[model samples]
Target chain A: GESVGLHLPTLSVQEGDNSIINCAYSNSASDYFIWYKQESGKGPQFIIDIRSNMDKRQGQRVTVLLNKTVKHLSLQIAATQPGDSAVYFCAVHNSNSGYALNFGKGTSLLVTP
Target chain B: DVKVTQSSRYLVKRTGEKVFLECVQDMDHENMFWYRQDPGLGLRLIYFSYDVKMKEKGDIPEGYSVSREKKERFSLILESASTNQTSMYLCASSLFSGAGELFFGEGSRLTVL
Candidate 1:
């Protein structure tokens, strides 16, 4: 089945270092993509988003890059901090599916001090 | 600020019991969604409502049903709860059924024994 999936399930990074998470999507028609951060016992929070028309989008400390040719997506977080420890998920919006999002399994990011 | 509120943070139910999870959004969004979060499974959409009284089944909607009688509220129902139905339920709302971020509630953790 065509779905969004993450390459790694867990990632550990040192505080002050940068962290990167990768995702692969199978659908070619998806036009929008979003990244969410989820803390323990809480709902997923919107981190950043990018559209297929643009290759990259930057937020406060995060950046999302999309490669339509290979159907790959990546999230880069700069200066990782202890508070940045959480699960990150990449979601793709299927316009044909009436605004539903296809989410990746998620990558657990742990920033060690 | 947009706020999505779930009725319960945790619930315990016996097998074969009927379960109901309620969600309400204050933003008067036109789209609402219900998803189940499990370890290694990410967010699996159970159902979604685009407008009042309009419902659509998601990928894993076999054991779930939804009700959206009003614009601000959406409900998820488990006809016969089973042990396998134990999971964290998340409710989300969006302004429209297009490319945008979803505002999610805290979540409801259900345990069926």
Candidate 2:
């Protein structure tokens, strides 16, 4: 079955270090992608989003990069902090009009202070 | 700031029991969705509503049903709960279509015994 997957199931980083999370999607028709962070006992929170038309989009301390040719996506976070520890998920928006997102298995990010 | 709130943070149900999860959004979003997240499988969509009284079955809606009596409220129902139905359920809302990042509530953790 077609699916989206994260390269790593868990990541550990030190405070003040940069962190990178990768995702690979199977559907070529996916036109939009989003990154979400889920803390303990909380729902997924929106971090950043990017459309297929553009290659990269930057937020406060995060950046989303998309590679349509490889069907890959990545999220880069600058200055890892304790508050950044959470499960990060990558979601893709289908090209069809159903307005649903396909999500990947989350990657647990642990920031060590 | 937009907020999505769930009625419960934790719920416990016995086998064959019916369960309901409620979600409300302060923002007048046209699109509301329900999802269940599990380890390895990630977040699977249960159901979604684009408007009041309109619902669509998502990827995994076999043992579940949904209701959207009002534009700001979406509810997920488990016709008969089972052990395998235990998971963290999340509710999210967004604007019409897939134009914006989704706003999510604190998830409801369901434990089916």
Put down candidate 2 lDDT per residue, A1-113, tens digits, no spaces.
34899999999999999999999999888888999999888889889999989999999999999999999999999999899999999998876636788889999999998
Q: Which CAPRI category fits model 1?
A: high
What TM-score should be assigned to candidate 1?
A: 0.98
Which segments of candidate 1 are over 4 A away from where they belong?
Answer: none
- Among these predictions, the greatest lDDT belongs to 1
lDDT over C-alpha atoms for residue B93 of model 2: 95
- Show model 2 residue runs off by greater than 4 Å: none
What proportion of the true contacts does each candidate reproduce?
A: 0.76, 0.68
Q: Please give, for residues A24-84, the per-residue lDDT of candidate 1 as tens digits.
A: 9988998899999999999999999999999999999999999999999999999999999
- Say which docking band candidate 2 falls in: medium
lDDT of 1 at B91: 98
